[model samples]
Target: MEGLSELALDHVAQYFSALSEPSRLRILNYLREGERNVGELAEACECSQANVSRHLSTLAKHGMVVREGRGTAVYYRIADESIYALCDLVCGNVAKRLEAQASLLGSLAPKKKR
Candidate 1:
């Protein structure tokens, strides 16, 4: 936020908003492997081609993924690998919180009769 102007902040908000959808996250995960054409992504995601295209549009808009046009076909790949690291960091914190909650529940359980 230090160097970000108001418009930059708005763009940043849109970027996060794009990543907020599960479908979009799954698309990014698929791209972690390598570039894939829209048809391939659509098949892997078990959704319609239009749906995949829409998700890809959002991902491309946020610069999370990059695409190339080869003749009439287009392929997409992850533009920012750091997004995976961010996801991992958040996942780890969630795991720790869940473990702590489980431990607390175990302590609060009624004791067995002698």
Candidate 2:
């Protein structure tokens, strides 16, 4: 049981590590729209082709995304829609927290000087 738990924890660590990169998050966000080829994804994410490919490779290895080749271009899409749902949940939680903080700050702000 301990071994199994350790394995599960390791898998979770890997998933979180893959998500720790801003570029990777951007790529995931772009993929949320639809499947896109490497070049198009690079353009959308504002990264180089090689950089995007590297990030995609990492995501592919972790089974978070999948690549499909057509003619000369290779396209990528989320491996499972469940990943998108998780991302949405996390982003929504963060947004709510930020909004609450903003409201608190607004309430604390003093009136403008005369």
Candidate 3:
């Protein structure tokens, strides 16, 4: 982010926005297993093909995933494997925060009777 131009920062925000949706996150997670077509993604994500396609378009626009055509099917894979590292980092931080909150709440709970 440092030394990045305003336009570049805007693009960064757009990329993050593409990742802000749960459906998109699920799609990425599924793709991590390997490339998958819309039907496979829809089935795994438990959504319609059209919905998965829309999310794919958003992810592709952000350059997060790449699509390849094969016969009547199109498959998508992660463009940058580094995304997993980023997701892992954020997930670890979130888990730590959640654990801390749970501990705080537990401390405030009423004592159990012997």
Candidate 4:
């Protein structure tokens, strides 16, 4: 928290909030393979082109994805690579917790019924 202003913390929170949406997360995950045009993204994401455009707009606004216009189609790709690492760290912790819970359940003995 040292050397960080309140405004800085709020900005960071906003960045996380941008990633909080499932559709936005899906867009990020799809872009991990490389850039894709809006039409391709819409088909891959199984949503309408307008919906995909909205998600891309939010990502572009937050500096999460880069947009390129080639002729009539617009392409999008990852802008901040660290977002994947952040997601991976959270997933790893959840996996560890689930593994521990499974082990605990496996160790429980079944009670005999009379």
Candidate 5:
């Protein structure tokens, strides 16, 4: 039973490891806006089409995003809105922490000369 639980945790860890990349995180953030074709996503992320496609594939495999084919174009969007909400929550937390750190630093800094 313990071995089975450990194996499940390892799989979950791998999923998070894939998301730890900056490029991938950017791709996910862009998708939160709306469904977009590969070219648009590439432009928004400032990455090559091929690179965006590869990251999208990884995200799709992990069920974080979904790909749809419209005629000849393939578009991607967040697989689950809940995931977007979770990402928003995380972003909010980071912003709050940064704001608090800045306030602390400001308090510790010497006053500027008049």
Candidate 6:
């Protein structure tokens, strides 16, 4: 990032933006198991087909997922497998921070008497 141009940084931001949505993250989780069509993803994500489609479109634009046509259905899968590693790294850091905050809050709480 130190030597990246504005355009490259913008693209990087767009990629992260695509992953910022919970729904899109859920969709990616499902795709991790295997390729799935829009309908399948919608059902798994508990979202409407249209909603999932919009997320998929964003994911595709970021090159995070790829689409394939199977007869009349369009299925999506992860384009860059490294995304899992990146997500795992971020999730781990977030979980650690949350745990630390919880510990701090617990210490600050008033003690209960029997």
Best by TM-score: 6
What is the C-alpha local distance difference test score of each model?
0.91, 0.92, 0.95, 0.88, 0.87, 0.95
What ranking emerges by TM-score with the best candidate at the front?
A: 6, 3, 2, 5, 4, 1
Query: Per-residue lDDT of 6-102 in model 3, one digit per residue for the tens?
Result: 9999999998898899999999999999999999999999999999999999999999999999998899999999999998898899999999999
For residues 1-108, could you state the per-residue lDDT of candidate 4 as single tens digits? Answer: 568899998888888888888888888888889999888889988999999999899889889999988888788989889878987887799899999999898789
Model 1, CA-based lDDT: 0.91
Model 6 stretches with alpha carbons more than 4 Å out: none
Clash count in backbone of candidate 5: 0
For residues 1-113, what per-residue lDDT tens digits would candidate 5 score against the true structure?
Answer: 35568778887777777787889889888877789999998999899999999999998988889889999999999887887676678789999999999999999999999
Q: What is candidate 3's local distance difference test score?
A: 0.95
Residue range 1-114, candidate 1, lDDT tens digits: 799999999988997899789899888888888999999999999999999999999888888889899999999998889989987887799899999999999999999999
Candidate No. with top lDDT: 3
Q: Residues 1-114, candidate 6, lDDT per residue (tens digit)?
A: 999999999999988998899999899889999999999999999999999999999999899999999899999999999999999999899999999999999999999999
Q: After superposition, how far is residue 53 of candidate 3 from its true place, in Å?
A: 0.6
Error of 1 at 83 (Å): 2.1
Please give each candidate's TM-score. Answer: 0.79, 0.90, 0.95, 0.81, 0.85, 0.96
lDDT of 5: 0.87
TM-score of 3: 0.95
lDDT, candidate 1, at 30 = 89
User: Any residue pairs clashing in model 4, and if so which?
Assistant: none
lDDT of 2 by residue, 9-114 (tens): 8998898899889899999999999999999998998899999999999999999999999888898999988987888899899999999999999999997999
Instruction: Output the better candidate (2/3) by TM-score.
Output: 3
Considering summed lDDT, which 10 consecutive residues are worst modelled in model 4?
103-112
The list of candidate 2 runs beyond 4 A from truth reads 1-4
